[model samples]
Target: MLLVSLILLGAIGTRLAVLQLWQGHIYRDKAENNRIRIVPKPPVRGNIFDRKGRVLASTRLTHAAYLWPIVVKQPDWPKNLKYLSQLLSIPEESIQSRIEQAGYNSPTLIRIARSLNPAQITALEEFKTELNGLEVDIETVRDYPNKAMGAHVLGYTGELNAEELKKRQAEGYRLGDIVGKMGVEKAYEQQLRGEWGGIQLEVDGAGKVMKVLGQKVGQPGKDVTLTLDLDAQRAAEAALGDRKGAIVAINPQTGGVLAMVSNPSFDPNVFSSQITPKIWKQVQSKGNPFVNRALRGFPPASTFKLVTATAGMESGKYPPNTILNTFAYLNVGGTAFGEWNRAGFGPMGYVRALAWSSNTFHGQIGRGVGGPTLIKWARLYGFGKATGIELDEEAPGLIADDAWKRKNYNWEWTDGDTVNMSIGQGFTQASPLQVAVMFAVPANGGYRVKPHFFDNNQDTNKWRTSLHLKPTTIKTLREGLRAVVAEGTGKALNVPNLPPVGGKSGTAEAPPGESHTWFGGFAPFDNPTIVVVAFGEHTGGGGGSTAGPMVKQVMEAYFKNNKR
Candidate 1:
């Protein structure tokens, strides 16, 4: 019995020796490696609001399934991933593929799925022992309450690419960080990016949090208020349904952009998710749906006659009463430029030329003012420059001169080009926004206002630049534009019970024998509040027939709602 007891004692001693001497250091090191880890917290982005405090873009709290890259490199990664896949009901291969695409050794957390169900979150927490390093994190994602509404203006956010990461690493941007890709979101990124916060957590060997060490409060981004009218924006978007076109409505007094829409816009929410290749291809396949067509330049057509008229009247070359015989066509440098009407109006004065949209009279007036004078006036009217709006991707419309023609096309500036310029054709280009501003000159009593999208305290005089029009010339021009809606091609816009609106109609021949229709005008004629410019691509009709009604509809809605 004594010998039996001795044998049991030795067995116990041998087990103790193996543990204390051999495996002791390994166990000690493992315990030491289980450290208080500093986990990065993402900042909440700011909300975006329209002029009336309607939320256009906001953020929502959501749960995202993530795979930590450092933990993903463990030897038992396959087993761990399999357990995670089962717990979350996600494919194991897909999780691995996501990790690989996100950089297998990257320090950043890879998002596997977004907006997890409550049950999925519970399973993740309950199965924490089996799913090592797989975390369900709380995150703030962009939410557009109105879906695709104002998408072009509000823009979208997405994960930063390698190039963007490299460029923005110094700005505290990391991999998997979402940044604005276009539109106002891109333009106001600095304002919208908030300060990130983090927490130090005491974790176990399996990466389970045992205690919260400390945390730093993160700051949310600043709210951005835009000069957009939601109701008017809805009206404009509804008017452009399914057609590839754009409409820009602005307050002529403040130059605030009321509504700017490019049809075929995508929902910004789709970009906030894990965008698949299929969805990306769909977004790209539809007419470059990302581009803001309102800010892009297109031919102005007969609407450009206003610029020629301005140059003619301003240069003292063609007065209001100056008569030009309108034959069927005007021959300049062997180019027969025909009037829009096959049967000529016979004789047209300057005002009647604009009222009837007589291409022949304007073509002669364009020549009388010459190419240089016309180009100078066009630039003076804010063409060939950005409209100074607080938005990205704004294009400076082109106004060609002798040097410009020689530099770009190696062609000389000719009388034919002048004639085309007079009729709002040829090499001259302007955006719908620019067109709205151009007409705002006569509408707002010849005062050139700087267009903007943000409200601030600045003197109105500081923002206002004078167009230097003689009061008499301004009066005559205003009278002629009013005549357009009363008795001319713009008669399509005349409403029965509403105040009279005055504007011009334009139709420019585009590629493949199609026409781009345009209408630029102001409401009420006397006390104009808004100037709307509508452009329709390949509409196969004149502006009076195509875009005039749209402008009329938008104006009617505005007046009906505002009642001022």
Candidate 2:
């Protein structure tokens, strides 16, 4: 009996030694965790503004539901999820995804649901103990007061998924972090998303908060001021009205984007909250409303004549006064490419040729200049590449030369192809923004300006390369474009009280569908300030009748607020 007693006493002493000396730190950590709690607080997202100081995007605080992974044991997880699913009307699957997104052993509170209703909030509060780990807190969400206006540019935000979290984890991004999905919001994400903070608390053994400790209250993101003009944007949208197209207005001298609009734009506010399955499917519907046509590539049609005209004059072959026989049609290989007029106006010079948008005249010039020179000039004018705007989606329109043809279609370049190229047909394409940048060259004294939204320290004005065209080339192209607005196809811009304008209009034939139309020009031609371009996709109408009035509307609206 004495030996047995001695053995039991030694066993007890050994257990105490192990707990006190070896496993002491682990138990101390567990005790500290029982007393300490941290509720992460997201910094208020930055506000977005236009140059006029009007708020374009801001944040609003709302009740949000958070789940503490530490408090919710694996055994209690299913029932707690059931409670949350019934109370918040969130699907069980969605709750599970959110949990997985934050990680099963995440030390921080995971945001499961937001934009909670009053009834749901009351239920969460009443059943707090029954639903382990769930808590109600304040959360900031993105808000767009203008709704769908400028939606493509403002973009939207959403919670981060597991993959997004993994990539952003190094940057301190956690699950449930709201992030910009597209547009300006996405282009400058780092500048727009500031630092995050946390709420410290003193808690009891049951994880109930006993005392408020303190907060780090992290810094908010810097405000982003864009070159977008509210007045011009409204006007452009009003002008576009339900049409499937895009319109762009720019300050020609500075390359500042004044206004941009894309039709069939979705309401970005929908993304600020939980997007229902119906809304998600609708967003993915036909026409893909999310496509920002302003930055998207389309057949430039007659608008591309500006490039053709430049290519023609720069080649030293077709001078300003050079005349081309503009008879009804020009025979190419086996095909007879007919002109717009059944009986073409004969013996036209460069000025009148551009004013008339003479396809045959340009085609002859294309034949004279050859393909390489035209492609070179086109590339120099910013075609075949992105315009370098603050967008991830800008399409560098196709500028197919002989080599491109060999690789893509395995076909040889032909004179007919050159003729088609001269007329802005075949593989050539440009976005409305690119077209604006093109016209800005002649508008701003031969400077190839980089179009932009944010001033980024006003470097955009200096972000230019000289075109260095001959004095005669610039003069002839400018005069021809002037004659277009003054007496040719772009006469629609000749409204009362408006300054002198210069532009060109054209239509590109799209066989199974109707033609795409385009109008690109500058207002106050003598000292151009604004370069506007309007593109009507599959409109079938002539550029003069379709896109011309849209440009007129933007110009008139801009001039209204910005009096010269």
Candidate 3:
């Protein structure tokens, strides 16, 4: 009996030792984990500045109203919800539903309102003691000082939804965090979004933050200084007027984009905050205001004649003085094409034909240069490829070849297609940005520059390192382009302040009776300073008539500001 009793005592002691010592740390850890909370602390985003140091985009502190459902007393919930809803301009039912959905066990923050003005915040603070559920917190929100100016370039920020959060979680983004949605904001998200920091606070049983245990301050994002001259941008947009089109201006020496204007732009400030369903529907329902026409593909029209000129000259098929007879119309492969002026120059040299933008001249040149040479020169000028700008949704235009036609449409190439392409017509399209770069090459002595918006300060080196043309070819092309603007179709819109501006004008026939007018040019023909391209949709006239004046006006403003 004694031995059995002793054994029983030993077993009890072992069990007690296991519970008191062996498993103590595990239970303590589980308890601590159950009570301890980890909340995300958002880092301060970087500031965006124009070249002149003007604040384009910044962040500011704003008051937000939230409900801590777990801490609210049952009897006070209704009164508190009503008071907060009325104060925040929100419906009382919404506040109640949010709280109920959050449940009592989970200490979730239910946001009632954001961007509360100082007066509203003051009024709410007075009742903080009485309303357990109501709380005021400071949060950073995006601010745009210039309203709608440079909206597309500056972009906007908004709260990350489920999908965005999931995609960017590896990049340090969290649910309910604000992220750059488009434009520069989206492109430089990593550089613009700095490291996030947080404060570790000891909380009471009621979820009220007590004395701060530890704090980690957030680092501000790096400041981004752009090369955009707001003055030039404003002038370009203004000159564009109510026309539905785009204007792109670049520095020929550096490839720095000075102005990029797409008319009918939206105020990015509207998107920075909470966008209403009504406003969203209106923006979406409207006719393509969101489409950035500067980056979109359109028919090159007569502006593409420069490519034909290049092919003809390089292939030794035509000299600068080569003469071609121009009639009112010409038939190739039984399809007739005519010049803008019903009566063409009876007999004109190659230079005069280009000066007059004679369609007959180009048609013949196309047939003479043939398809292979035309395609080669077109590819050399960077057509049928993306311009490699930092923006999203860029389209590589169609460069049609016999093989392409056979594979895609199962048709053979003909003189009609060749003639059409030579005049910048059927199966050929280019973005305004592309045309501007194309013009810049010959204007700047044959260095084909990749146009870019962000100013890297190293743009000159970048351009020099990546230039894609022979010096002789660039020089020859420059003279032809110079003549086009000096005495050719582009002369009428030349600005006196700009020295020897060279350009080409094109009137692309749109679908059934409409036309898209285009003007692409570069200034100081001998030593180029700037290159500009403008396009107007459904403009009844040629590039010289419709798009030329706009480009001239923008260039005039730009030069006026610089005053070299």
Candidate 4:
């Protein structure tokens, strides 16, 4: 009896010692976890400002309700959801969806409702002890004070999805992190989204904060300053009001985007918070309201005439004053292509053909330049590609040659194709931004300025290229463009008392749709300071009537406001 008692006592003592010394930490940790809660401290989103320090985007603070799944059971949701619905007035289904989105096993707390009002916050606080898995905390949401003024430029933000979270998990982005979805917000996302931190909290069994353990406030994101001029943007949009069009105003010397306006813009504030299904549907209603038309492709119309004229003089095939014969239309392969006027400008020089926008005359020039050279010159002017701006949606406008045609359509290039391309028709297309860049060549003395939304303190040689164009060619092109506004096709832009304007007006036939009108102009023609390109999609009217006036308004605004 004594030996047996000794063995029993020894075994019991050994077991107790093992538990206390070796395996005690595991159970202690479990107990500690049950009593502790971690509250997240979200970093404030950065502000966005225009060149003049006008606020374009910022962050506003609000309260949000969170759910900690650790203490909440699966069966408890229906009753708790009902209680929450009654108190907070949020739909039970939405709360369920948020819970499901975060999953029951989410390591971090799940935010079920955001932008909570004071009433909702108070109700949640008053019933905190009875509510399970419910937590209230401070949240930050994006705010656009200007609303849709620069929506395309200053894109909105949204929570990170499953895929985005997974991809950025290694980068330390949490599942509920806010990320930029478009425009400058997207372009500089890394620089704009700052580091995140958390608050280590100790709470009672009811998920109420009992004591503060530790806290590390998150770092706010860096503020971004854009090159946009708010005054210029407002003027441009006002001028383009309600039209299915876009307008771009740029610095001729630096290629800085003074203003970029796309009509039918969506208010980014609608996306600043939780987007309702009805709001999403409404946003998608119009023809892609978010698409920046300034970056989208359209027929260059007569704006492409500058390319043809450049090809004409650069090839040394057609000199500055060399007269080219033109008539109502040029007939080839038993087909006659008609000009804007049935009676053409007859025989004329480069300056006259450009001023009159003589289709037949440009056709003769196109035939002389051939397809390959015209494509080369256009490519040199930065057509058929993106301008490498801060945005990603810029369309590389199409400029196909014989090889492209053969590959895509199994056909060879023809003189008719060249004629159409010369006048910025057929397969040739250019964005309003591209047109602005194209016109910048002569405005800044034979340099192709790379268009940019951010300030361009960049090296001059890097952002712009010297075309090395002949002096005579530059002289002829500038003279011809000036003549366009002085007395010819774009005469509508020659408003009295305004700075001298030089521009080209293009009207391209769209066949199934109305013709697209384009006006690419530079102000103070002698020593140009700004380039403004205005486009009217399927507007039916000519460039001078349809688009030139838009350019005039923007130019007036820029000059008048800037006092330049």
The most accurate candidate by TM-score is 2
Writing each residue's lDDT as its tens digit, candidate 2 over 357-386 gives: 888888888878888887888889898899
Per-residue lDDT over 1-564 for candidate 4, one digit per residue giving the tens place of the 0 to 100 score: 999999999999999988888989976766676677777777887888888989888988888888886677778778998988776666898777777876675535778777887888888987767666777888888899988887888877888777788798898887578889999989889878988888777887766678889888789998988888999999998998888889998888888888998877898877655566677898888778988999998888888989999998999888898897888988855668788899887789999898999889888888888988899999999999999998998999999999999999999999888888888888988999999999999898899988877763667677888888999999999999999999998888888757899999988787798988889899898788789999888888888988998989988888888775
Q: Candidate 4: where are CA atoms >4 Å away? A: 1-26, 81-107, 118-123
Question: For model 1, what is the C-alpha lDDT against the true structure?
Answer: 0.83
Q: What are the per-model numbers of colliding residue pairs?
A: 0, 0, 0, 1
lDDT value, residue 376 of candidate 4? 91
Candidate order by decreasing lDDT: 2, 4, 1, 3
Q: Provide the RMSD of all predictions against the true structure, rounded to 1 decimal.
A: 5.7, 1.7, 4.8, 2.8
Worst 10 residues of 4 by lDDT: 99-108
Candidate 3 lDDT over 1-564, as tens digits, reads: 999999999999998899779998876764453344333357788988877777889987877877655556688877877777677767777666555544653344555677887878898889878875566788788888887677777778876665676788897765456778888888788888887776665566655666666677788788888878877888888888888888989877777778888867777777655455677777766467667788788898988988887777777787565778998888887788987798888887656666678899888888998998898888878889998877785678878999999999899998888889999999998888888888877777666777776666773757643335545556656666666777878886555666668788899999875799999888767677888899997767878878988889888888788775
Candidate 1 per-residue C-alpha lDDT over 1-564 given as tens digits, one digit per residue, 9 for 90 to 100: 999999999999988888888898966654444455556677888888988889999999889877667554467778877877776666788777767666655534567777677888888777656655567788999999988888988888877776888899999887567788887788888888788787878777677679998899888888899988888888888887887889999888778888888976888898776566677888877877878889889889998888888899889988776888997899899999997777789887867787899999889988988988999889998998998887768999899888989999898899999999889898888999999988889998998777777756467676678898988778878887888888998987787855878799999989886799999889878899899888998887889889988888788788877787
Error in Å for residue 385 of model 4: 1.2
| TM-score, prediction 4 | 0.93
